[model samples]
Target: MDTLLSIFDVKLAIENLPFVLSGLPMTIAVAFLSMGVGALLGLFLALGRGSSYRLLRWPTRIYISFMRGTPILVFLYVLYLGLPEVGIELTAFQAAVIGFGLNSAAYIAEINRASLNSIDTGQWEAATTLGIPYWRTLGGIILPQAARIAIPPLTNVFLDLTKATSLAAVITVPEMFQKAQIVSGRSFDSLTMYITVALIYWPLCIVISAFQERLEKRFSRYVNE
Candidate 1:
């Protein structure tokens, strides 16, 4: 009982709470920065894949294929280590953001493509019959509707990216997991520190999930119609 109690170390966890939390800002920066950049890239990729031009479609396909096939860690390592060898240096934070952004963009592209395709073909025809410009029709009619469908899935991907930010620890970005590792290493209370990290992540994930649920409910009427 005493050994288990010592391992848990509630007092130490409480004492180091702020230290562990200090990395929250960096973690959030990485997650949201990736999501923001990824959304834009993903939108372009989706459009490229859907385009009639072989020049656009083929290149986008290859890019998505390569990104999806490669592991994010490998991408991170390539950016952080391989690039430096070629004189393209990147800070750990920059490397993490780029890696996460590229990875997230591939998944986001697929999700956006699926959502865009789920929109009816007749809508495009109707807009054409009305003599609407293609870009205007897409912007005013198609994308808004697709966005409603895409939000839930995109939010899920955002959450996944947030969790994956833990991988940044490998490059020493000093994110939440890395902070926990440092605290654990110093205190020799790995169980307690690790559990504290879980506790922090759990609440954050729950809050994001709740926001997604609310967004889904708000769009339910449009989907039902």
Candidate 2:
């Protein structure tokens, strides 16, 4: 216990807590911003994947395949480092957000596609028989039902995105992990800083998971009725 305490440097961790926490806002910003982008892009990708036109379907399929196959770290490097070679310089934050957003969209697209597909064909038929336009049927009837099925998976994606924001440190985005890295370097105690950051992430994820449970229950109630 004494040896562990000596290595961990609890006093240093306490002292640097504020500095480490200072980056929390940026971490949250990157996560939400990336999620927003991913949600929008993923929705369109899902729709495209389901479209009747081969042109739309094939391209979306290729995009999803490529994005899913590639490592997100490489994508981030391409955006932040490789793009500069083509005179397309972006700030670290911009690169992080765009990279994470694009990568996450592939996963979200699959979730959206699966959710949208899960709605019964009878619902579509009934809407069509009622003289509802395709868009109206999709928006007014199918999507709401599909949303209930989607909430859980989408929340999982959001949770993953939130934690994955730590990868932004590679490009020098001043997020929580980056701050923790700074603290670790300054204090010469990598284990404690990394553990502290992990502990911080644990509570944040727990809160998000609790919120997911409430959201699932709320949506499930609507479905039950």
TM-score of each: 0.93, 0.96
Best by TM-score: 2
In TM-score terms, candidate 2 sits at 0.96
Expressed as tens digits, the lDDT of each residue in 1-225 for candidate 1 is 999786688899899999989999999999999998899999999999888999999999999999999999989999999998999999999999999998889889999999999999999999999999999998888887898899989999999999999999999998899999999898888899999998899999999999888887887767677
Q: RMSD, each candidate, Å?
A: 1.8, 1.2
Per-residue lDDT of 159 in model 1: 90
**Clashes within 3 Å, all models in order:** 0, 0
List per-prediction Cα lDDT, in the order shown.
0.92, 0.92
Candidate 2 residue spans exceeding 4 A from truth: none
The weakest ten consecutive residues by lDDT in model 2 span 214-223
Candidate 2: residue 176 Cα off by (Å): 0.7
Question: Candidate 2, residues 1-225: lDDT per residue as tens digits?
Answer: 999897687888889889989999999999999999999999999999999999999999999999999999999999999999999999999999999999999999999999999888998899888899989988888878888899989999999999999999999999999999998887778999998899899999999999898988887865898
